[model samples]
Target chain A: EAEVAQSPRYKITEKSQAVAFWCDPISGHATLYWYRQILGQGPELLVQFQDESVVDDSQLPKDRFSAERLKGVDSTLKIQPAELGDSAMYLCASSFGFNYGYTFGSGTRLTVV
Target chain B: EDKVVQSPLSLVVHEGDTVTLNCSYEVTNFRSLLWYKQEKKAPTFLFMLTSSGIEKKSGRLSSILDKKELSSILNITATQTGDSAIYLCAGATAGTALIFGKGTTLSVSS
Candidate 1:
């Protein structure tokens, strides 16, 4: 079965540093989602994309976080001047559409020191 | 706001035992309910329940949704140690986004 791909399985950075995570959805999937999972908590949506356009990002902290899916195939999420509270697991998922079967990547574990 | 609540927070079982996990939701324009298994990193999809009473099954795992009751149940039979993981329940509305519950941690010992 095809799987969503993510890079930099783990990352550690200083509080004031910048960090980025990448995700490549399964081939042919048009809907992509980025979610953050804090320890002992369920994953929360950070952003959603339909092809290359963003559809929802209501909970994303625009002040320090930005995500882009420029090509409609893959995506990138970045956090500038990271804060300690930013430490968490970033997961990428995709599906054919909003209500289709979803697939998730292993995710990137970020730690802001 | 959409909300999902899972019961019993955690469970401990021995190999060969059967276990049932519960998920209840309260959301507008309900579309579907999903169950996922999270081991260490990302959550892997297990079952998606769209209609009530029609059970979705794969091997020893089965799930059913009761639209009237607003709840769902996941059943795992002849459990093995490999079944140990965190189980998450989520509710999806008319839109694409899903509202997730905290999840239940299940540990299967030999």
Candidate 2:
């Protein structure tokens, strides 16, 4: 089966440093999502993208986080001045539409010291 | 706000045992309920329930949704050690992203 790809399986950065994560959704998928999972908790939505346009980002911390999918295929999420509370598992998922089941990437585990 | 809640945050069972995980939701404009299995990395899709009274099954696993009750249940029969993982339940709404529950951790020992 086709899979969503993510880079930097693990990352450890100092507080005040910048961190970035990348994701490439499965071919033909038009809806992409970014979620953050804290230890012992379920994943929470950070942002959602439809093709190249953002559909929802209400839960994203705009003050320090930004995400873009300029080509409508691959996406990038960046956090500036990472905080200790920012440590979590960042997951990327994609689907043909909201009604379809989503395929999740392996995810990037981030840790801020 | 919209939310999904799972019961018995953790469970322990032995091989050949049957286990049931519960999930309840209070999402506005609810569309569907989904279940996933998480081992170490990302969660793997298990089942999706859209209409009530329709049971979805796969091998030894099965799930049913009750819209009237605003809840769902996942049943895993003859559990194996490989079934040890965190089971997550999520609720989908017509207007927003999925709302996930804290997840139930299941440990099936030999």
Pull out the clashing pairs in model 2.
Answer: none
A57 Cα displacement, candidate 2 (Å): 0.4
Tens digits of per-residue lDDT for model 2, A25-104: 99999899999999999999999999999999999999999999999999999999799999999999998875687899
Query: Judged by DockQ cut-offs, is candidate 1 incorrect, acceptable, medium or high?
Result: medium
Question: For model 2, what is the C-alpha lDDT against the true structure?
Answer: 0.94
Question: Candidate 2's residue-wise lDDT over B17-50, tens digit each?
Answer: 9999999999999888999999999999999888
Tens-place lDDT digits, model 1, residues A5-113: 9998999999999999999999999999999999988999999999999989999999999999999999999999899999999999999875575789999999999
Task: Give the least accurate 10-residue stretch of model 1 chain A, judged by summed lDDT.
Answer: A95-104
Per-residue lDDT over B11-106 for candidate 1, one digit per residue giving the tens place of the 0 to 100 score? 999999999999999989888899999999799999888874348999999999998899999999999999999999988877778788999999
Clash number for each model = 0, 0
DockQ of each model against the real complex? 0.80, 0.77
For residue B32, model 2's alpha carbon misses the true position, in angstroms, by: 0.7
